[model samples]
Target: MTLIDEGTAYGRQRQSHDAEIAEVGAGTPGGEFMRRYWHPIALSAKVDATPQNVRILGEDLVLFRDRKGRPGLLYPRCAHRGTTLFYGRVEDEGIRCCYHGWLFDVKGNCLDQPCEPENGRHKDKVRQPWYPVEELYGLVWAYMGPPNKKPVLTRWDTLESVKPGQKIVATGSSQGAGGDDTVEIVPTNWLNDWENIMDPFHVPILHTTFSGVQFVPEMGVMPEVTWETASHGMRYIAYRKLEDGRELDRITQALFPHTRIVPDIRLIEGPAAGVGWVVPVDDTHFRLFHARKVPEDFKPIEVRHYEGRKWSELTDAEKQMRPGDWEAQVGQGPISLHSEDHLVSSDQGVASLRRLLREQIRTVAQGGDPLGVTFDPARAVVKVQAGNYYRKK
Candidate 1:
């Protein structure tokens, strides 16, 4: 067990992952916990007359808007012959299966069966699978849990208090961070990115020092950090003293389920203007949906640059030279094996996030409601406490 033989890569073994907190399928603990809250499935602008295939929580679904202007999400298979509805046509009533010309409404109610007698004498007996969907904050939210357990779609105070001429702009690309260009679907487990929200120490190291000032010079200063558990999830505050004699308190939050409310990287004052959701496409892939308040005709500023080139403009070699979150998270492979992680004092936030998630998973396993979910409309709006504040020392 000397240095020559101990802890060597020659015979090192890979450890198993924490599947209970990572797997997001129909019946898994993590999936069931996620189902307790509504998640953004698509940008409202993306769901149009053309049927688009989407996968969420490990289920394949088709999303489209009917001629009546109602958005619908349904199982892709035709109820009769199992043909994918992706080839189906959108109609005034709903969508029509190309196979037998059977028509179903947005709610998956069979409306007509052209080949059957009397428009299908038993058409009423067949129903296509569908999920409950609603449009809010420029995104389509869906509830995939038990119908009786569906809670009111929670709203955010930050997004609701839009001033005149300001609107909530929703982006579903590039990890949904409001970036104009970047990878859409992240090829990794959702938890990898979700956990990163709590680990603020990486900002100064990875984005600043390692990536050569990706955000701003102020972000490069290492800060003293503290973590706290909120009713919804958990939050952290990073304290830094600026050269100009102002104490900076940057607060970031990871809300229950999968929402991250982070202050602007430039240390903008006031509460966080947007929220991002790490949505699981399946066990190995995920996507991000973000909604933020901005002025009319607002354009995204390219702040993260490496060697005088924007992230989207960088070549593969440049990306490696100036790695950012995408490189760090995706580099962890499809799923970061939790068993291999060696926790440190600085990883308190990451540790707390995992603990919170585990508690919710256990709550669902015991047939109880998870955190941050409510049936009361009066309590549906979540008040965000994340922001950047400055005080004179």
Candidate 2:
């Protein structure tokens, strides 16, 4: 018997796992866990006299470079009157609050307090909130964790393996401007984006099965994968059988916290790209920062843009017909409900990654250093093992 009318009610019940994993504020478990490592905040070329608004780890910050060429990341609100430093002036010494001419250096040391005369005895007592920032490989990275726990910012081998005539190119959307073929702020949790790197099965299905062919032809064939734990993170070694009676071995890596080393989408004729970071803008947003070394004379590589139109410009039917990772990932509804997902054999990597992240979180909770953190500069250079290999028939 069919009922005359029926309706379904949606509940907002959330799980403890989701709350622990998704929330990334200062006091939150995920935030404290992630802050133990350095994360990309802005591209080096983009930081200048103008103060840009940045949000990371659920905190609002202002990023700028002083006249003397020192980059800074500080709490946007002025310490004196809670005025946003976004309108502050960038001086040779540091940034000066426009409200009352209070000056602060990159390290948040109070340099001068104009309103408080007599050498401003109270100036030394007041310090604005700030984070430690450093630049490497054309990106500005910040460590938002405890000062004493700051780790040496690592320089991965891929970024330094460039040939004599080749240089690294910084291409990504930052502060509302950059190369046209770069990704902007993704409207989903950072984990959702990071998890995709582990799920190799989706490549043959999402990029090839539903859509005609968005990636390399070799990727159209499904792969048999094996996951292994690296010193810093995890790696997925995938093998694909090709029509030429040769096998393809693609090794992809996900460095602890956020960085992911992905292969060329359309197959690389030259050297593979350097590691790129999946920086968390906040709990609900994230951005991508990628650097690839290319010949000095090389121009920007053009990627397929859905008939030359951006993803946002595509129609609903168009997106449905040519669904990409953006659709598949963001479709997980911001922070995917981890408790609701059913783990299977194919989800081994995802499960492993989650366990590793939880272990790191637990380590931090136990007052121990997480993986890959070091204070010694000499030991900061990491060699990443990720590339594509083709076997001879």
Candidate 3:
């Protein structure tokens, strides 16, 4: 892709991801559009021993765990002489730049500049190139939004789906489900995939037609799905429970700005019932991370190839493979063109998501509250009858 000239707006010239606006990212409005929330960078496990370099929102970063079991996110370079911090050593406090011994804490606070003044130091006066990071739901998240207004971390029922005891006592239980060690990344753009998490209407079509059947027989009965904003992104509460119509299906929720509570976890050798997270690498590229805890008898398997450079980097071949999402979004162009979109009633989920997104994005700009503002831990087995495949009349 050719670099857009300064002040030159760039986006899909054709029917893209319903997007045409340039100035959305970085110097453009597109980059600024993405700089509104906290983005996840790595699985918590990635922050051990050696530092891991990461790129998010077009910025380079370094990740590592401290000796005290604290994970840190820092600028890729040392403030001193601009040394790359990815080669830094993990210490009990934070990551220490291997060169000149400049130490920085997880928050990027310069702790020790050994080459500088001795006695207790003036390191606290300086800050290294870094951002605030938090470990939640088995991943390391960093806020690339504004220097302030970082939203509170929202929780999801899936994290508590399994009993704590089940985690410790279950024999040979795959810890990925209930534990905090498993996090996988699928490269793509945030909008293309994040929209999928909210729109369940695609499964019976895309997965069944293009890919293959991945849903249960009960899924054949697509029920009418109703959506509402909650402590999370949007809740697609199904009006129909199942094919049998007896048991009430629990609500499917997407935690804003990313992550979802899937009814199925792809635990078995086949795709199990599962939840997924769409993490932003930048406006153009992102990742899907799914941590599953399958049945003791189930074994999940799949293969993914990493051919792209970081989140902000994409080769033409990598661009073509944009994964399934690429075909869904970019094929439409840089942004999906809404003007050319002929949405049918089947696009209900997509309609709802877009409506809510437009609303929330406006709210965010006006300094108003976004969805999933303050979570209520009221767990209920609500009967959700979403649009499932029902036998036609």
lDDT of 2 by residue, 270-364 (tens): 23566778788888778888887778898865544467666566787987887777777677777787887898999999989888888888788
lDDT of 1 by residue, 223-286 (tens): 9999999989999999998877879999999998999999987787889999999999999888
lDDT of 2: 0.81
Output the TM-score of candidate 3: 0.69
lDDT values of the candidates?
A: 0.89, 0.81, 0.56
TM-score for candidate 2, residues paired by index: 0.92
Worst 10 residues of 1 by lDDT: 174-183
Using TM-score, rank the candidates from best to worst: 1, 2, 3
- Model 3, span 1-393: residue lDDT tens: 998577544764554454322223554344444455555667776568688877776677788888998887777868888889888888888888889888888888877877666823677777886677887657677776666556555443434455533321111111221111232333345565556656656555544443234334444446566667664457675544544445333356665556555654221122223455565565555555655544444544422223423323445565344333334544544444567677777667667776766666566666665654432335322222212222321
Top lDDT model: 1
- The Cα RMSD in angstroms, rounded to one decimal, for candidate 1 relative to the true structure is 1.8
Tell me, by TM-score, which candidate is best: 1
